[model samples]
Target: MPIVYRLRQGKKMATNDRVWCICVADYKLFAFFTDCGLMWLDTKHNIWRVVSGDMPRKLYGGAMVEYYGKLAVFWRERISNQKQEKIRCAVIALARVGEEEVRGTIEWSGVVATIPYVCGFLHCLVASD
Candidate 1:
């Protein structure tokens, strides 16, 4: 059974960040933010920690899902070049939460693949196992 929880508006440790996606894995709450990157919130301790390593710079209208037993984040890359691009770049990135070399720390992996010309809002659904 999954335990129920709620989010109450309060002062955040970090500001100017927009939450895009959230996922629960191994009893831990993970939140993906647009400006702050990925964060691992320790519910038991009531503290939040940011995951290091390669991560998407932005996640405004992205989608996240659990695929192949791992969390996959799909989002569109913001165009920076002023060369009048026709198609936006879409990416599918994967990351797993597990033990780190420091024993109690969490490490984030890098992107898995990058595709071009993908559109629409990304969404994810987990099937009952």
Candidate 2:
């Protein structure tokens, strides 16, 4: 039988929203991506928090990987001005967080690269220690 994991939602989720990827930094501490944005889940307490305030653009699809103690997200960022979405990479590190919700203190975040003409859905990213 397959195992099902139900999470408490912080807000309403769209019908098309789905979890793109999940990275577990520690026990019960997981960060995941949805069509809306990046979100945090505390399995211990069964509560969810929105970590990503405003993503520059919609992430069509992608994956999240933990590398060198940092969270890296590789996805296609939709560009309204461009015909095709660009492949971008980002590094996320937690700066400040509360027990219930994620606060505004993000240690650092930035776009590492933007590969032209590359479809993010056509590839996958892997990380190793």
Candidate 3:
């Protein structure tokens, strides 16, 4: 389910950031990747945390999905000064969260499979056996 709340003034996550993707990881928590970095809302405590773990700057937009108790954030980045770019995916484990937690940590991150050309608006789905 989706939970909605109002933003208070002078808080950390109240910046003018453009949201790229949002994923709800159960009932009480939801996370989104934005221009300012990764942020999550703790509905029970009414708190927000900026959890962009080791993510390089300048990722304008991306996609996120919940899979096997983890969040996979897929985005594209400029790989070279010649304008070469490629899609990347970051796997984040959202366990052990608390009201005072600043941000979630990225357990593992890496690039996606080789693509011949540029692309945007990434999406992910989960499967089970």
Candidate 4:
């Protein structure tokens, strides 16, 4: 028989908005909000705490993936004038959870080659290590 599972949202999520990324790890639910960055929702306690530090701002059309038991986020960053009509240049960064830190710190591993402003989707694969 197929099993039916349901997740209940509690008081912790009462004021949370701008939910950008959501993932589950080791039975703990994690959510990354664009406005407030990362937060850990304590399902048992019905509480939430900021994951600490500032996440990349002005992020859009980005992608997040789990690589080798770690999280990796990649986004197209504007490298030129913010107000330029035809601004160019972009960056793809890779970050993972840090160690010995209460709040997870993102360590930018590397970036990908730059590309023109193309409206499409980019996918990444985590190779077996």
Q: Which candidate tops TM-score? A: 3
The local lDDT score (0 to 100) that residue 45 gets in candidate 2 is 79
Model 4 residue 56 distance off true place after TM-score fit, in angstroms: 3.0
Clashing pairs in 1: none
Tens digit per residue, CA lDDT, model 4, 1-129: 222122354223234255655655434455655666555665555555565555554335555555544455555655575421222222222233543222454555455645556543456454765
* Candidate 1, 108-128: lDDT as tens digits: 434433444344554445477
User: Per-residue lDDT of 1-129 in model 2, one digit per residue for the tens?
Assistant: 222345565445445456667676433354454544776765667866677444423455677666555566676666677656566666666544556655323345555546554544443455556
User: Candidate 1: minimum summed lDDT over ten consecutive residues — where?
Assistant: 100-109
Highest-lDDT candidate: 3
Judge candidate 3 against the unseen true structure and give its global Cα lDDT, from 0 to 1.
Answer: 0.62
Ranking by TM-score: 3, 2, 4, 1
- TM-scores for every candidate against the unseen true structure: 0.52, 0.58, 0.66, 0.55
Q: Candidates' lDDT values, in order?
A: 0.52, 0.56, 0.62, 0.48
lDDT by residue (1-129, candidate 3, tens digit) is 233335554234344556667777633355554445667775556656666456544456567888777777777667665455677887777655455554456788888754544555644765879
Question: Candidate 2 at residue 7, lDDT?
Answer: 54
lDDT of 1 at 22: 82
**Candidate 3 runs further than 4 Å off:** 1-15, 26-28, 33-35, 52-58, 81-84, 116-118
